[model samples]
Target: MTPHNELRLLPWSGPDGKPCYLSTDTTGGPLSRLADHAESAQLAASTELLEHAREVLVDETSDPEELRLLATDLTCALRDALRVAASRGHRLPETHASGHGGDAGPSLPAAAFG
Candidate 1:
């Protein structure tokens, strides 16, 4: 059994935003190391995506197709980022116990912009 302190939880989020920890007790555990490396890559991709968005915004002749592509990429990147945050035990800035917004599958909550 690995000692509790031998494990380090990365910023990576798990199921339902739970923190994912890497057990370092076994000096040569490949899975943990791989997970950490993948997480780092995800973070780097996010940074790159943000910078690209800035460039596109300032460019006057941005292509519509490129914009759509960017939107798709941004959505995936943002979701991953949010999952990492959630895994670190962070709430998603708002409590949406109710539905997301008006006519959003279920009727909107009483407080609109919450």
Candidate 2:
């Protein structure tokens, strides 16, 4: 199943003053969705790398260097995806007391992600 389907994500304001989400599941109460998104993308990229690695392993004359290159490519992709995703959200405290709260309170912007 798609990773998005397996979790519940709530809109949230990120460090960039943009809208993002906090994800949750049946088990974990609430977690950062950006992290989840990054992880999912990383997994997909890693899976693709594994496929390429397998192809290299199958070729009798394939050099071990090819596998190393594939690993490096996978690592780069994963890192970039994670960086992008993690930057999309900001962490805020779970609650705010009245009187101290103001118009500047953290909130998820409507179009931040899009």
Query: Which candidate leads the pack in TM-score?
Result: 1
Cα RMSD of all models vs. native, in order, equals: 11.3, 13.9
Q: lDDT tens digits, residues 24-57, model 2?
A: 4332333564455556766686678768877887
Query: Each candidate's TM vs. the true structure?
Result: 0.53, 0.35
| Lowest lDDT block of 10, candidate 2 | 1-10
Look at candidate 1 and tell me the lDDT of residue 86: 51
Clashing pairs in 2: 14-89, 14-90, 15-90
- Candidate 2 stretches with Cα past 4 Å from truth are 1-31, 71-114
lDDT of 1 at 1: 45
Candidate 1, residue 77: how far the Cα is off, in Å = 0.6
Candidate 1: tens digits of C-alpha lDDT, residues 1-114: 433344555656678877666655453468756665766788899999999999998898999998999999999898777756554443123334545553424556679857
Error of 2 at 79 (Å): 11
What total of clashing residue pairs does each candidate reach? 1, 3
